[model samples]
Target chain A: MKLLRNLVLAAVAVGGISAAYAAGAASFPHNLVSGIDAAGWDLSVRKADYDDDEHEGYRRFGGGHERHHEDDDDDQGRNYGQNGPGPAGSTTPPDNGLILKGTAPKVQVN
Target chain B: MKSFLAVLAVTTALSAVTPAIAGEVTLTTNLRNYGGPGAYLAYYVTDASGKYLGSLWMSGGKARYYEHLTGWYRATGGNLGEIAGITGASVGSGRTLEVTLDLADALFDAGYELHIDAAVEDYRDSPNEIVVPLTSDGSGQPVQGSRYIADFTYTR
Candidate 1:
């Protein structure tokens, strides 16, 4: 029957163009983290309200928000490594190298 | 036999380091709204036979909502390089996320276990929710979180 109605109209036009390209790549909206990161008490409040390459601060401070840091490196927050940490699993070495057992997390929440 | 191969390479480098003592480990979470979207959450660590040991934290950083964090993407199958640099963000809905990390004292009283898997977007993915049990008399007590996690705690 017309090749199953042209394969159901090409699977509904490829699922409506992949849901409109995932809603145009998260066009940004619907975010509502709420006052003081939902009141647990600011653990640097998304690094003082977003930076380090936003897009939700590159998934909570892995890096990228056009690199600018330094109010003594956001007062030694975000990348918390005392002096450029991150080197061992959890995304090792430079940005996104999340440094775990090596330590870093003086207090971070968002 | 060369002194039993140099005492089996110094007992395999002292049984791969387990002298431990470290400290600090706060971790606190609270979320509930079940509205939809923004929730990832991972936090893993297991032993007493549960196995899968690794990943400390990883609050949603996208990556397509990590398959609704289904038991930490089936215990790290969704790798993302084991949550690079630890990760953060995405914890809204009645919120609360304390975090503190450093942890070690042999992951507390030994027989470790600390989990949390959550996931939301279209809702319903909850995974392990929260397991807790790194007892030294349960560290600093506080627990409860089965669906959208209303509360959970751990301390030292």
Candidate 2:
């Protein structure tokens, strides 16, 4: 009867220890997952504003370069030469009338 | 009786040392010169069947831009909690980002994969930029990325 009691007690102690170890191992993965999740979210928010601005700039400038105009005063003079060499024909249409249109370049992970 | 005692001592020592033997692993990703401002990179893990396990690291720091990481966002539903503590600075073009942490031993030799989703401002969002299998044989092997990432490597 004493031997039976000793075996039962030993079994319970081993079982208890094993259970604790298993629990700890299981929680390790969850803790790691949670920790990484928080860090990624925080990083994402920090760069959001910069990303938005970049997107806007790409849409406006095409590829980060601005279109240049020679001179406002010489605009009419240049057009005059192209349109029959007269003020009447030159003044009919504007020389700098070029329309730029296109959606912003798509942002992608690379 | 002496043999039984020896067996118990060995079992105790093995159990105590097993956790300590599960050392840490570091992952390094280097981006290419894509000519963009900064690249937002998401490092995540997936199970054998391609099910999302969890995020490992996030390079860019922005909440709104998380949606641009379409693959991660779709799998995690833009869950911010998945990468909170593991967040860091955005990686510039031609720059490298490294993350080191103690990973469970079981994760290796198990059918798992590490995936990266990269996005830059005004550029097309590239999901699954790099996908590498997790295996004992794959350690220290540098794999090239498809779009933005130049290469990725893992070391113990």
Can you tell me the CAPRI class of model 1? incorrect
- For model 2, the superposed segments whose C-alpha errors exceed 4 Å read A1-110, B1-21
- Please write out the lDDT profile of model 2 over residues A1-110, one tens digit for every residue: 99999999999999987898788853446677678887874424443354544434223121232223232121111222221112211122111111011111111222
Off by over 4 Å in 1: A1-90, A93-110, B9-33, B40-56, B62-83, B88-103, B106-135, B139-142, B145-148, B153-156
Q: Chain A only: TM-score of every candidate?
A: 0.18, 0.23
Residues B11-71 of candidate 1 have per-residue lDDT tens digits of 9998788564566778888787766545667888878788777777777555544655767
TM-score of 1: 0.27
Residues forming the 10-long window of minimal summed lDDT in candidate 1 chain A: A57-66
Tell me the TM-score of each prediction against the true structure: 0.27, 0.54
Error of 2 at B26 (Å): 0.9
Docking tier of model 2: it is: incorrect
Q: Give the number of colliding residue pairs in candidate 1.
A: 10
lDDT by residue (tens digit), candidate 2, B33-128:
887767777778888788888776666555556677778989988766665445555677877777665565666778888889987765777889
Candidate No. with top TM-score: 2
